[model samples]
Target: MRNVAVVAFPGVQSLDVSGPLDVFAEANRFLLPDEHYRLEVVGLEHGPLRCSNGMTNFADRHFSEVQDGYDLLLVAGGPGLVHQEFADEIYAWRT
Candidate 1:
């Protein structure tokens, strides 16, 4: 199974994260039901991630703690995208 990690941070745009997640989920549902991508919503730190609109999302794991075998890493963008801290973090793992 493919391990996919979706990176979530404060002020991240919902669509940026949800769009690919929806597509991946649907594709996995039809194309690889028996063995498919394992999706993980990860945060930079271990806590709730507040969106640009103020909605909070609890993450499954911290970015530092994520296992090393992921097949894909998705970085969500929004107002937070301009932050240098987030950029550094994303660049560190983007391949």
Candidate 2:
């Protein structure tokens, strides 16, 4: 199985996160029986993230704990991404 990580944060656009996910889910249906995407929700911190629409969802892992190996990494964007808070920290982490 290929690992797929979706990076999410507070005020994230719900569709930005869920849209690609829907495609991934659909792809799995057509793949060979031995292949499938293992989707993981990763967040800046451990716990649930609040969406721009006021909905909350939990992540499977924290960004800090992520290691070097991942088939794909998707970053979800929102209005909150314009803020300076956590920017430096996240940039450093990505490097």
Candidate 3:
């Protein structure tokens, strides 16, 4: 199975975290039993996270604590990012 990590934060748009993941999850229904994606929500910190829409969700793992490499890493985007910059480690990871 491929490791898919969706990076989210305090004010992410609910859709950004849920939408594509829904698609990936649905895709698994038609794929081979062993050939599937393992989706996880990664946060800067591991614990409860509050979203822009007033919804709360738990992160599967803390970003800094993610030692295993993910096959796919998707970062959620939203209005809350208007004044925030991606952490330096994020850029390093991308590079």
Number of the predicted model whose lDDT against the real structure is largest: 3
Mind giving the per-residue lDDT tens digits that candidate 1 earns over 25-93? 888977656678788888876688888877787778887776576788887888857763644664575
Report how far off residue 71 is in candidate 1 (Å).
Answer: 0.4
Residue 71, model 2: lDDT of: 90
Query: Residue by residue across 44-71, what tens digits does model 3's lDDT show?
Result: 6558878889999788977877888989
lDDT of 2 by residue, 1-95 (tens): 89888899888888888898889999999998569998888887668889898888788888888776679989899887887377566778761
Query: After aligning candidate 3 to the native by TM-score, how far in Å is the CA of 53 from where it should be?
Result: 0.5
The candidate with the higher TM-score, 1 or 2, is 2
For model 1 the local lDDT of residue 27 reads 80
Instruction: Identify the leading candidate in terms of TM-score.
Output: 3
Better of 1 and 2 by lDDT: 2
Error of 3 at 47 (Å): 1.9
Q: After TM-score superposition, what is the CA distance of residue 37 in candidate 1 from its true location, in Å?
A: 1.2
Clash count list over all predictions: 0, 0, 0
The number of residue pairs in model 2 that clash at the backbone is: 0
Model 2 bad stretches (over 4 Å): none
Worst 10 residues of 1 by lDDT: 86-95
lDDT of 3: 0.84
Question: Which pairs of residues collide in model 2?
Answer: none
Q: Each model's TM-score, in the order given? A: 0.80, 0.86, 0.87
